[model samples]
Target: MAEQTITERIGSADQVLGVSRREIMEQMIDFYKLGDGDGMRQMFEAYKNWEVRYRDGKRTIDETIELAKDNFDCVARVADGYIDSGDTTVGMVRAVQLPKSTSGPISEFYRKTIDYQPFDPNRN
Candidate 1:
């Protein structure tokens, strides 16, 4: 079987950066897990740059832990600073309902209904 282009599956968009928006986001927890300052800094940078293009995933351990109230206050800042920086759409979000699957792994998949218009700070 053949795979569909991002648009063919997602419908419409100016660009399809990658499967996931950012690597730091996925690794944010790792930074906390290892108490790695460097990883934390990198995650912070990635968080600040919310619209950074898709990044390749790196080797990381799977774990979850609790953060201090102060730390959560700090990390909660991630929810801010997102804005549409350009006219073109940068990403998409899949609906809750799953469409029929194509051949291959199902862990990472795009949908056929939407072109995610997320916050981009570069719009002028």
Candidate 2:
């Protein structure tokens, strides 16, 4: 049988932009070989599905949000990055901080942050 194309398997901008579903699966296998847990597998699958859903049917802005809410819930905290920046009395930047677990250190844990863009010295 002919090998399936990435586009045929996962037709998503995420696949087009960077790695593909097959690649993600391969990476997961590698991680598993190294004794990774089921949690990692779950994360990879969830992330991949979200990417595919996000790219489905030329979705609109509202549709994208709805799709995202439906697919990935654990990492949805990232969307809440902008907590109380402007107009709010507190003026505090809120974010979701993942607790330290078997996955990794607390410092290395994923957290929702207002600053999405990478640090660029030239931009300033």
Candidate 3:
């Protein structure tokens, strides 16, 4: 069997995970640019594992995507040198020792603040 390219692997994962293939490919490309092949592999593995574990369950695809997102976020943070020391009274505090700015699509997603709009049944 021939080896699959990264895009092919990501496409397969997107089908299994019920996520947008474009999103997965973008993330994989970001990791590749950072030279973090292991992180990209981990993200893909997490998706596969989630599919197997929840294949016959009542869990929704959104839940699985959230789990995958968490894994991706942790890997990205770690790659930027944010080590998880332990939980604090406030919450889990990651020790940010690296001087690099957390500027990326994933970082932006995590940092975005939600603005709630009033319910308008007629809008949609």
Candidate 4:
């Protein structure tokens, strides 16, 4: 019915400066899917465990997608930069760029587990 505060669910350290930690992990998985890195998947498994531990389904899914989008956007930005600069290192750097808040669309079905902030589906 209502979103759980970070304290009630995941701890505060996992929260990024602007985005939720769950979002970060989810996005990293997406990045892994896009050939970003294998670590993302590993991170996903870890987060999944945390999801069970905290009973934080909503936050887990929400953050997962957000992180995916963040990773994708970061890579896209690196691609754009390389396109403009003709430098290869930029792409390489993008490969290592961490996930962000604007990752992807995690299912809201998690409402049963924890409180979630209403996200605008239209916004990435």
Number of the top candidate by lDDT? 3
- Mark the regions of model 2 whose C-alpha exceeds 4 Å error after superposition: 1-17, 42-49, 52-124
Q: How does candidate 2 fare on TM-score?
A: 0.25
lDDT of 1 by residue, 36-100 (tens): 45544433333323222222234112111111112222222221111122111221112112221
CA displacement after TM-score superposition, residue 47 of candidate 2 (Å): 1.7
Q: Write the per-residue lDDT of candidate 3 for residues 1-124, one digit (tens) a residue.
A: 9975544554465335555444454565476567665666565665646564655556576666555555454444443332122222111123134322433443333223111122224454
Clashes of each: 8, 0, 0, 14
Q: What lDDT tens digits, residue by residue, belong to model 4 across residues 1-124? A: 9874333333322433233543453453344346544444344334444444444466566575555444434544444334445564654354346232222222121221123333445556
Q: lDDT for model 2, please.
A: 0.35
lDDT for model 1 comes to: 0.26
Top-down lDDT ranking: 3, 4, 2, 1
Per-candidate TM vs. native? 0.23, 0.25, 0.34, 0.28
Cα distance off (Å), candidate 3, residue 28: 5.1
* lDDT score for candidate 4 against the true structure: 0.40
TM-score of 4: 0.28
- Candidate 4, which segments miss by more than 4 Å at Cα? 1-59, 91-124
**In terms of TM-score, which candidate is stronger, 2 or 4?**
4
* Model 2 clashing residue pairs (backbone): none
Worst 10 residues of 4 by lDDT: 104-113
lDDT preference between candidates 2 and 3, better one: 3
